[model samples]
Target: MPTITTTDGTEIFYKDWGTGQPVVFSHGWPLNGDAWDNQLKLVADNGLRGIAHDRRGHGRSTQTYVGNHMDTYADDLAALIEKLDLRDIILVGHSTGGGEVARYLGRHGSERVAKAVLLGAVPPIMLQSDTNPEGTPLEAFDGIRNGVLADRSQFYKDLSVAFYGANREGSNISDGTREAFWLWSMQVGVAAAYDCVKQFSESDFHDDLAKIDVPVLVVHGDDDQIVPIAAAALKTAEIVKDATLKVYEGAPHGIVGSSYEQRFNADLLAFAKS
Candidate 1:
């Protein structure tokens, strides 16, 4: 249970394992660093340092009622890397964590980052507005907020379907996967999760996206029901100078845990090696 104290004194929980070039993983919203357990084992076996950290208000980290925004998320990650003096790092971020990675690079990047990967990430912008009219609508996120605020348990249960595309025809739904989703959601602070809906949904990462200079690999599912591949992956590829985009057919938002998990991990490792 190793931890790093952020600039604001928040104790952020992190897992640093194995020995080699480091690959720091930042997980999606409502899920902890444990989401990268599979990736950790695979990367470690391949002689790479697999590091994953739980953001504040998620998992073992402090459940403060504030500082759940993108700025704090990026700052916390920067502090962790600085404290560790990690360089030539490979940063892999999923969902909202992608925004965190982009912001961190924009704020604290110093030639330390070698490569980056964004998997079904939230970036450029998630919400549709004047500047980002092609993004998801605010009403959609509001519905998510309403559902979570009203009945968190059932809300997470229903979200599982879209998260893994379990609702689709021929999709298999397992009790273990459903339970894991619930457990991960429950580990997140209710207040922080509620407030973070704005951070992930409305926050714009256009500047951050434009700032990334390292080689970037964008992996997205074509059937992602949560964050559309077009608005996220395609848009991100256009902004990042040196970026490669890969799309999985019929894969859900949780492509990393779906049948394509191994493929996703393989691509990540290949990218790290190249």
Candidate 2:
């Protein structure tokens, strides 16, 4: 279990495998770097170095009662990258992890980072406000917060369906998939999970997005119900000057794990290479 202690003393467990150019993956809320398992295997076999880390309080990382915000997440990642002295890194972040990626690049990135990818990312602010009129409502995030505070287990279980778009018509509700998602969610602390709701839902990333000057790939599913493609990915492409958008029709939020795994992997590799 390889780990790097952040400035805040949190030990972030990470996996650095393979060789050649490194592709670092940051996972979504509540889940660990294991969420990028599909990506790691594919990238590693294709002659690229693949790395993924368990965010503090998620997976193998130490669970702390404090410091579970986007800035902290970015800072911790920056520390890891600096400690390892990684270069030509391709930063890939999904869901809340995308916020961390944007903030990391905004605050610390330079010529070292080759490019970035935001897949079903939570960014440019998720909660609706006067300025972010197209974002999700604060009440919606509050509902999630209340549910997690009430019963984290059940809340995560139910959210699994929404996150994978299992509720849609003709959607095959896989018990195994749902169970895996629930287990992943349960791996994190209730407090960390709850705090991350605000980290992903309320924290603004518009300024961070504007600061990126590298080629960015935005991969999103049109049928994604957890984080709508319109409000999240599409808006992100609009904000990032050098971003390219790839919209998958009828695909859910977990595009990499869902039925579109082959297509997703191929497209992602293509984007990374190009």
lDDT winner: 1
Tens-digit lDDT track of model 1 for 1-274: 7999876778999998898999999999889999999998888989999999999999999887889888999999988898888989999999998989999999887478999999999998889877777789989999989988899989998898899888889888687887898899988889888988999888888898888889999999999999998788999999999999999888998844455897898898899899
Summing lDDT over every window of 10 consecutive residues in candidate 1, give the lowest-scoring window.
254-263
* Number of the top TM-score candidate: 1
Tell me the TM-score of each prediction against the true structure.
0.97, 0.96
* Per-residue C-alpha lDDT of model 2 across residues 1-274, encoded as one tens digit per residue: 7999987789999998788899999999878988888799889999899999999999999898899988899999988888889999999999998889999988886567999999889887788878778788889999999988899899989998888888888888689888888888899988898899989988888889998999999988888887887679989999998999988888888754455667778877998788
lDDT of each: 0.89, 0.87
Per-residue error at 46 for model 1, in Å? 0.4
Worst 10 residues of 2 by lDDT: 254-263
* Cα error, candidate 1, residue 178 (Å): 1.4
> For every candidate structure, what is the RMSD over all alpha carbons to the true structure, in angstroms?
1.2, 1.3
Error of 1 at 125 (Å): 0.4
Clashes of each: 0, 0
